[model samples]
Target: MAKSKRNVVTHGLSGLIGDLLVFRQRAGKTIVANRPKPSVKPPTTAMLKVRGMFRKAVIYATNIIQDLTRKAEYEKAAKNGQSAFNVAFADYLKGPEIEEDLSFANYTGQTGQKLVASIIDNFRVASVNFSIRDAGGDLIESGEAEQSEDGLDWVYTTTVDNPSFAGGVVIVKAYDQPGNETLVQVMV
Candidate 1:
């Protein structure tokens, strides 16, 4: 009776019309138009593609920094070695002047061996000490070696090896071994 002046509309038409109406309300209460809830699921294939690009960029940046740091360390060591070499060469040109003091450092070695070194002059070597222990941190073996110049190229200050633990930690003491010393180069 109240709608006699207006055309009757279907429910579907009313819904369609309601969608177009902005800020609509019913009676005294607010009429919020129904909307599709946003998905809370994981990213879709398209989203993953975008994320993967960013991820790869991050990895590349990290590796670049790591490589640069390693190069810097090598360069510093080379500079030191070169200076020492120049001084030694000048002495050699003058012909063995009173056996000047010399030192070696950054020694690294494999398992099960004692350090051995024999040189004309008294000196000390820097060493890389490896300690393999049980869960309780009890030292299984300690290994060390000495390098002449760069830490990468070295001679086993200790000459002891076993077939059982060829690659494990070994402990050795620096001693004068009157014969050939095993030469070793640390791998990158």
Candidate 2:
């Protein structure tokens, strides 16, 4: 790949020149590269699935770009040389991620005990849900968590008191703006 800087012929030029080279603009700079060749072999099942997923991401990005408010939000989050559509498409392809394991050290089967979780997403995390289950797999409590002021952590206050929470399980599900969910389970 080569960068075209102030060249008379390639300056501000984009698209394919003949069948040999492809020119494009990025971050106010012109890029020159060889034309990519099409694959001759048939796509495998996994490749087809990935293609389908990318198609869905394209559709999602198109919808986001159509909405003025949502497009502005994504545009604000976009970095240099990145467009709103690019950020939205990448966010749709990737779900929310749990930054760390759930900490139950403060949760001692007492009412009003708080459980905190750290989560992150490419765009924005919409919500976090907390669920507790006993040793027998019976649900003890479930509710939505509140986002912290700094926007990095989610806090959930326990409502019910379960003295036998030692062998229980804590489940946390984090959701991104695109409704993609990431779940994590930890033994209490």
Candidate 3:
């Protein structure tokens, strides 16, 4: 790939000039590259699934930009030269993620014990849900976590008391504005 520098004809040009070269604009600059060759092999199942997922992302972005309220929300998250539709589309493709190595040391199956989780998303995390299960996989408690005032962490207060929580599991699910969910599990 080469950057177009002060070339009069191709300075702001985009699209293919011929079958040999392709020109595109990115980050307020024109880029020139060789035309990509069409794949000769048949699409694999994984590739088909990815294409379907991207199609859904496109539909989601279209709906989001059409709604004034949601569009404004995404626009606020967009950076310079980035559109709300692009942000929404990228958010749809990349779901929320729960930071690994979450600290569960404070949770001891006590009624008032608290668990804090850090969730990362491209745009915004709408909510976080936590579920506590026993060693036998029996659900002990489940509830929605409250987002911190600074909007960095989610805190969940334990409701049930189980002395035998050492071998139990705590599951956390983080959701984004696009309804994408990321689930993480930690052993108590």
Candidate 4:
């Protein structure tokens, strides 16, 4: 058995529509073509009109869906406990919105003990101030609280040695970066 030669053959088309083919073989190269064009109907004005109608329909559908979603969100906010249900851009720009959602959780302290409070903020809390008041509404001790490790809450800790923290009230004030403050009173 003998190994055949690895011959290279070329059968490529030329011109814009690839209608012409250049052939190569043992007889050399040749170029001859009488390609017949296929019949095709050119795009008409009706086709363009249909395409424009489809585009308009798509745009109208998208806009209606967006409007419905926006209205639903606005209504939900209004129904809920949103203080400023009016979605004015100017109101949002006016300083930081006040967050009365300050809450204390898992607080473990007593009178004459190390009064430690956990304060949570709905928004960005910048500072947490705590004050121990007497029964007569007099301020006995006031100081800023410390932030926790999780960066989510503020921790207020102080010694209840002033004797005002017994039957008195614990005032926790939370301030956000937007210059909004919230005060909460907790009974000792």
Q: Which candidate number maximizes lDDT? A: 2
Each model's lDDT: 0.35, 0.92, 0.91, 0.52
Clashes of 4: 0
- Write one digit per residue (lDDT tens) for candidate 1, span 82-164: 53323222222221111122222322333434333332212122333333333333454445545545423334433433333
Candidate 2 C-alpha lDDT tens digits along 126-177: 9999999999999999999999998899999999989999989999999998
Q: Cα deviation in Å at residue 70, candidate 4?
A: 29
Worst 10 residues of 3 by lDDT: 1-10
Off by over 4 Å in 1: 1-126, 131-140, 150-152, 166-188
Q: Give the distance in Å from residue 5's predicted Cα in candidate 4 to where it truly belongs.
A: 66
Clashes of each: 14, 0, 0, 0
The regions of model 4 sitting more than 4 angstroms off are: 1-123
Return the candidate ranking by TM-score, descending: 3, 2, 4, 1
| Worst window of 10 by summed lDDT in candidate 2 | 1-10
lDDT at position 101, candidate 3: 79
Residue 66 lDDT in model 1?
59
The alpha-carbon lDDT assigned to residue 71 of candidate 1 equals 34
User: Best TM-score goes to which candidate?
Assistant: 3
Error of 2 at 169 (Å): 0.7
Arranged by lDDT with the best first, the candidates are 2, 3, 4, 1
Which parts of model 3 are misplaced by more than 4 Å? 1-6, 18-21, 24-37
